[model samples]
Target chain A: MLGRIEQKVLRGGRLTPEEALALFETDDIHLLGRLADTAAERRSRGRAYFVQNRHINHTNLCLNRCRFCAFSRSKGERGAFELSTEEVLERLEGSPEGLSELHMVGGLHPEWPFEHYLELLRAVKERFPRLGIKAFTAVEVDHFSRISGLSLRETLARLKESGLDLMPGGGAEIFSEGVRKRLCPEKITAERWLEVHRTAHELGIRTNATMLYGHIESYADRVDHMIRLRRLQDDTGGFQAFIPLSYHPFNTEIRGGRPSGIDDLRTIAVSRLVLDNFDHIKAYWVMLGEKLTQVALLFGADDIDGTVVEEKITHAAGALTSEGLTREALIGLIRGAGKVPVERDAFYRELNLYGDRYEDRQGDGAEAPDRFRTARARQ
Target chain B: MRKRLHPEGVVTFVVDRNINYTNVCINRCRFCAYYRGPDSPEAFVLGRDELFRKIEETLEEGGTQILLQGGLHPGLDLSFYLEMLRSIKERFDINIHGFSPPEIHYIAGRANLTVGETLQSLRDAGLDSIPGGGAEILSDRVRQVLSPRKIRSAEWLEVMEEAHRLGMRTTATMMFGSVEGPEDIVEHLDALRGLQDRTGGFTAFIPWSFQPKNTELGETVQDRPLGAGGAEYLRIVAVSRLYLDNFPNIQASWVTQGIKMAQVALRFGANDFGSTMIEENVVRAAGVSYRASRRGIVDAIRSAGFKPAQRDTHYNIIRRL
Candidate 1:
């Protein structure tokens, strides 16, 4: 069974849903990893991507209290915070130079209208114009459309006009309706999420896609989720990357243990093999931790996400990784995996390739010069 | 090599529970997340009732031995350990495999006795064997960075040698993937092989990866791979199997690596699945919580094409499934 699938994958043929499911159930992890690694090398020519990006989770005062989310809170809750536009700007003010992107996502505020999100995006863009703004999930976009009494296309047009360069693929949890009903019933359905991304793509705004695994979802549900995204990507080549979010189970209404490292790596490998339309598969270090993320690079992941300065969402759910990683640390992690570290923008355009010439470039006053020096000495 | 080592095509595991008697420690190693200070709100020493209850449960569940270990509490003397061991022995007829070298060395220093004297006293108090807990890298160069306050390499080896000379068997372990290079790992294996050649009292060699979730070392070592990966783990298992020719057994740590990777390790070189670990808190404190029942271990071994057997502390087959 795997032989036929391997031949199809190696020969650049699309995998049927049954074949992908078989790949998921197979215990031959080494062969699965090897095939996925070959597929990844074909897509990305040995260059792993990272961005000098910062995350701004503006508010946690959410209306739809998803059972799987520990980051959201009620309005009067003790830890619920709503950052004003000035506070958001102030948070970005502390960001280091050479920062290429600002990833902003938050809970659905019940009171704030859609204009508030537009104003926030415009304010961030007017201040840090060079930082590409990757803001909002498809779920948030649908909420914006409903709040503003506008169509989905109109709402996305206003957001794009307000300097939203890209959309992060969050809130897509699992596309299977059975799991979605229990996971986050109040949130938008899978069809609406896909519609929001499709409209965003039609309006010339690229985005990424994600699937939240390691919760109550099954292997079949995961394969279904990826196939849905692959079908969408097949129509609109808009997804720049596909991220498999490892479900961190801490302080959530659905309190389950985190998945094993084997499950995490297998999900990454299967996503790379199944999501053939996606050019990049990100091992988001904020959730996977640095060590597992390094191993994921060998298991068919081509991106380590980014430096992820001040990632509050996963940390709010008891992520053990640091809130942020220095640029030198990201480089060290990628290099330690024996891959070329290519610093990319929000759209994954190569901004700086830290290859063999990285040592010489370290002396030219990169960020955290002392730390970079120490990293060099260690190498 | 695997076939030559095990001609009967059997993989063995011990049905034991790691009972940490106390959490208070003075020599808090950086890579350890299980130790607590003397005055911390979470510091605790198991009472006699709780210890006996745990042993009774283990015995009820067909567990043959108790891997009794603990942190070196500053307030507890040798009498505390002696009482704990003697009380358990008086209550239950189970094998008591307790105390790594660092704990023995610390107890010896506190009581002003030699290593041999400490082993003799513990044996007299009903310690059946010793476990290898605190031997992180077995190189002074690496030990200085990881655990300077703990026992030195020579002291750890001296305590193990003393136990062997006392006719008490012990296991050896290596916690790699933390601030150590390949040379350091080689040095650790070389030290274990040399000792096994001399004494032949070392029962098995277990190499588990260093899980760096809640440890201070995880915070400091941010630039490199925090711990060894699955491939590196398999490489270490294969190398240890080939290098330590005098050692009789190699254990795959499912506590650190999950069941799937542990099954893969059986193909690499491991002849034993380490333990069922009905209760494990040390790795849980490190943010990795992997649990396996005896049925799960047996199933994993059978699926990996090896016969599963339950063994005691001395690797004697107590039952075959």
Candidate 2:
């Protein structure tokens, strides 16, 4: 019964922790790996992908004091900062050229009119009409909705009309209230975060999902986070990927915390093993560094995040990354890991291999059934 | 190699900077939202001067080591690393605890050298040790599905073993919580345990969660099971101490799990508080929140009902915990 559901949920044909831990003690490591490998491989079947874009932190100024945040700057703080559209556009221009997407998000400012964001997107679109904008998290959306007295749909629609292509997965720190209250109490509740994402999906705008792990949360809570996301994905099919956000406990409001390496690995492996509906398991290179991210691939992560020509919020949080990247460097890292380097669009669709041509990216349309069958037979 | 963290009278610890020389990478592993492509204006390889400046800063701050790691970029040559290591050694008094399994594998493949020879060359060039990295859930099934193109389970261990025999001490790791079943977790443990029984080279075993942000995978499924808590984290810590019987010191993962869990881990299994990390990115980008001070490590260990001891990268407790 246990293995049955395990396979159904993850397709890895493994048993639950309660069952597997018992066998692990007895040194049945091979059987265990087989089961985990299966589940991980199948869970993210077509979705292990990454995007080519840049991240823009419009402002670190905020009214709320979310506990888990290290990047938020109170308006009165010496470190508080807000970028004008011109400043943001300068940052965008400095963004790696040929980038098709712009990832914009920051704190929910109390003073900036909601239309400030709209205007920012509008200006960017007018300046770079071809570039897609995947901006704002659910919490930011909630902040905008309340501040503007607009419905979630109306808000998203207005943004879309203003060039908001999609939503960036943020603010879903964890689904458990116990943890939320202790970690980020002032932020939108987990339910509201989900509601906004659900609303975004309902409106036909795709978004991403994330979990900021390695902080004050439990294994069950991690599992609950995944189950809830799976259910949501089943409902909307709007979530394009699952990025495991590693919580960095530095310059943050929280106390008594540090990063957990093993826990991070467990989350990634387990995510691929259990999140049967999600496609991609990304190692956010910015957070995990390339070494762990590369290792994450073997553990069940297929996608490495894209070129962040400029990542502000993390830098403001003291990420130490002050420079952007060139595509050659990225391809070098992927190929160095012995994986094929493919560039992806804002959505999960494959644009082509890093070095492949547009025509080469042309999906061969449905693998010749016989070819895959033969390949499987060869296996 | 007697790779054991034997407690000594002096609590020896070294100051180091984890120089991720470059954020440029090709592997688009989900759970990662970092890494820029070549030509990505964001992309960069730490030039010698830039790296030297970092080392100079660390040295100025009394740092004695450098844990240099980066994505598996194809352009870097063995000479590149050799030059960097040589430069660091030539410039400052620093120990190089750099490179992981996948990196060695890539280096070997790129240079057409064996893992043993690769370690041998790097060690000859002032490379001191390897971190417990990329040993994410060590199941081929999980590896193929998640990072299909990276090293396989056997390869990861094989590289570690090669490092062990090559006289390079290394660490083992398990990244759980994604799609892995309990059995998969077990398999990861057993693999590490068996390796320890053989080579006894793995200095410590660390486990962590996945961080999904700014990546392709971050676009799909909502991150579930949030993250491990003190209780669950302790359970794993205790289990590792209990399970990796051949392994002696299990380092509490203060880097990803935080100090509270690290303190709790001492009771369960972990005896060593990890390095006084000057900089860490991978897990932080995934959103794990916290940083530990050297004094904080001492305090946390004391609070956890143990003496806080400082140790070198080799697990030899210089200070009593």
Candidate 3:
């Protein structure tokens, strides 16, 4: 008899909540990987999408210090730092030329007014008008709405006017109430986080979604989280990609080991299967490390996030993957997996298509006698 | 080794049927399971009705050609091949990619004609092109052990070189992972490379693993390997692309590797998806039963991130999708 999940997958039907939970229990990692890979291939057509962008974490000091986060620091604490507008501009000046996006997300600050964020965005945009600024997470947006006493839509619009081109998908630590209450009770509720993104989508602001996994979250909780993201994507069509952030537990209140490589891959594969409406599924190399992210490309991940320079949040949580990767190195990683390395921009617009070096040799029977002799001698 | 050797993003395949006309091969090689002795129950050539039926079905499936290759039947005269080709050409507007180098050599010897004269006669009867059959491993040592009664490596190249001189195009193939080692494989490739250097008449090079199941050779080996997995297949494909510089196209044999690995081959220097074998018997007789329809080939090519196209036997684009 065919298993229910297999039946659903073979029929190309949407995975139900129960079926997804069942699939999450499957130990046949290759099956799940193949299923996810088939789905990803159908969508992306063998081209893994990535971007040349810079990550800017503006501040690490926050009022709501979630247990899962190690970057948020109390006021006056050691290693606590916040970037002023001048400091942000100075950091921007160090970014490599031809960067297409500026990704910014940091802790919720207690004293900085909403205008501080606006001024920082404006200054960066004035410096590089072509750079798409994908700043702030849903939690940051909600915090902005609350502190500024503006509606979610109004706050998003004001930020949009202030040059916030898109929203980052973060702070959606598993959508289950139990997981949220334990890991981050002070943070916004799961419903509120979705509502913030929904409002952003309604305001014509494209956003990405993320789920932090491998920390006190059940298989059911992970499935439910992705299903909810898929539901929102179905309604809004706003989520550009769904990223399953592997939880890092170094120097954090939540004391547990990091997710195993299999766990990380399973989550990524399950995300690709469940988030059917999401076009891109990302393996954030920063969180999952570089090796696992490379493997995740075959496990249904078509995006390796980006060449994020100087990432602090995951690095603070003890991520051992390099703080940054060169664009050439990133292209090599994708090519090593036998995929076309496409350099995409902030909005997933393909900036440059890096054709593999071997693909260009036309072999026009053009023979160089010396080179042929050398090759023959070596063989 | 992801190279775009072709300017067009489209990966081309031929919608053709590999219709074996005769199973009564005189050389009953040890590596083959499809051939039979003339007295065997299955050692019968396809009658005109069966041949026309296969052609009709191929055309119905939107196939533009038929890969008509067969064993060297001892009794069948060269006139038999000519009449079959003429009848197919008169009846249907399908390309007849008939006869391989070995078959051409055998037919010429039996009819007391030169290889050029034989190929010209077949071409006049509307033999559009030739399939690269029976050029398994162009190393005589491998050929002696695998199929001793068959033509030698040089004779195979001689037939192809002569066909090219007669203005006829053909494909080249290698059936490796049998008794051939890396040096022998290189020798095989070197022969094709050398011949192609002089006469660039070869359209593509297809390297497929020797399917061992149900074959006499499969039964003879005590510890038979799993043939060529994707990694080995990919390595050969990559090397073939780098080595066979004179050849324009490399084909991924989905008949033996299945569709997914064949799709992966598009990135591994294979610019063509061989053929959607509407009717295949050789590999099927070897106990690997992978089938590809026209739509399946198109989807496989597209899934591999290339535009899928239909091409003629000569690698000319027939239609692009």
Highest lDDT among the candidates is held by which one? 1
Cα lDDT tens digits for candidate 3, A18-72: 8788677875666888888888998889988778889988889998998878888
Candidate 2: lDDT over CA atoms? Answer: 0.69
Q: Give the Å error, residue B213, model 1.
A: 9.5
Q: DockQ for each of the predicted structures, in order? A: 0.21, 0.04, 0.01
TM-score of chain A of each: 0.95, 0.84, 0.93
Candidate 1's error at A325, in angstroms? Answer: 3.2
lDDT of 2 by residue, A1-379 (tens): 4345445545334335544333323222223334444554555442334566888888888877777677787888987888999998997777655687788888889788888989998999999987878999998898899999999889988988899988988889998999998887788898888899999888888888999886777667777788788889989888877888877666777655445444455567667666667767777877765444544554567787777877665554555322354554454445444455666667655555444322243355422111221101100
Q: Show the lowest summed lDDT stretch of 10 residues, model 3 chain A.
A: A370-379
RMSD of each: 5.9, 14.0, 21.7
Better of 1 and 2 by TM-score: 1
Off by over 4 Å in 2: A1-48, A320-323, A354-379, B1-320
Residues B130-197, candidate 1: write the lDDT tens digits.
Answer: 99889999999999999989888778888888899999999999999898999999999999888888
lDDT of model number 1: 0.87
Error of 2 at A343 (Å): 0.7
